[model samples]
Target: MTAAIRCVLFDFDGVLADYDRDVRIGHLAHFLGRPSHAVRAAIYASGVEDAADAGLLDADAYLEALGRELDCTVPADAWVDARRAATHEKPPMLSLASKLRARGITVAMLSNNGLLMAQSWPAIVPALFPLFSGRAFCSAQLGAAKPSPAAYLRCLEALAMPPPATLFVDDNPANVAGARAAGLVGHCFAGITELQRALEEHGLA
Candidate 1:
């Protein structure tokens, strides 16, 4: 049964890496001279991040919108730096992905990140990504951010594989449940050790 699985889809942010929303919010608020709570409310409460992740807004458009919400013009690099501030890549998981690929399994990223992540993250950590074999897919590029069945379906279509043969891993339980609803095996990521255990449980690693 494990042999039937060919592709492993990983979620970024809380899984492959950790991000500091507080730091990001602080940076944005300081740069825009807005209140800290305002930054958080606009991004999380206002659904602006979702809109950007779903590709309703491109990087520039997203920036423009964010600026409008903050009532200031934000430098592109500032936005990038804000997001990148507390980003910590998980080397162990990356190494595991490399090992999986070496054994002929496909390891790809499915992140709910905006175009800035697609553009800036690679530039920020050019070497951290080569392990995934350049098979990275972002919500901004796909226009179907998860928790949506469309996003999972799009991934299967793009990979040219059936849902039964794919495994989706994410830190968010909601996202994991969404993947399961889409007919793919879903693993809610807790930590590197748990993820390694999960891969072995599924005979992937």
Candidate 2:
């Protein structure tokens, strides 16, 4: 028999909000007075972001590294501003999360992001961030990135919930597969309509 889902873990960027890489690059470029391509290369091509997400760098170290790559001082506030500018909320997804919470299902977030993202989530997704509050788990904090079963296991451990009774939702199939491998029921988020159907299967929607 299938265990009832008591908690729903959501992936932040692609699931709950839309993140525009171009917008983030542009914002950082403008703030640093560098060209957009340079900002993008420094952030993405440098592998600093992946390292940060994997807990190789803390918040201050992450910023320092980014600053070094961009050839300028990257302030925390400026980084937060760039992140906020790039994150756009998905109203339907937010509504679905709220509805799940109202139904007594615990809704939490788990994202493959750096510690700065954990710090700046309130600014990035002001309305939805508070709802996750203490339940928001990031890869930096977990010391592992999604698509790694360790990440899912660590998040489940923190939640004190058994994996069999939790539901993990992400836009990435690889991440979802990792969650499933960790023993949680995983749903690949395509759209609100499809997600609702998945939740319904779990008796959540």
- Give the number of the best model, judged by lDDT: 2
True-structure RMSD, every candidate: 1.9, 0.9
Candidate 2 residue 36 Cα shift, in angstroms, is 1.0
In candidate 1, residue 98 scores what lDDT?
82
Residue-level error in angstroms, candidate 2, position 133: 0.7
Runs in model 1 deviating more than 4 A are 1-3
lDDT (C-alpha) at residue 134 in model 1: 57
Task: Estimate the overall C-alpha local distance difference test score of candidate 2.
Answer: 0.91
Q: Kindly report the root-mean-square deviation of model 1 from the true structure over all alpha carbons.
A: 1.9
Candidate with best TM-score: 2
Q: What local lDDT score does residue 31 receive in model 2, on the 0 to 100 scale?
A: 89
List, residue by residue over 29-118, the lDDT tens digit for candidate 2: 898899999888888999999999999999999999988998899999988889889999898888898998988888899999999998
Error of 2 at 151 (Å): 0.4
Give a tens-digit lDDT track for model 1, residues 52-164: 88888888888888878778887788887777776777778778778888899888888887887777767555556667545777888888889997888897788787888
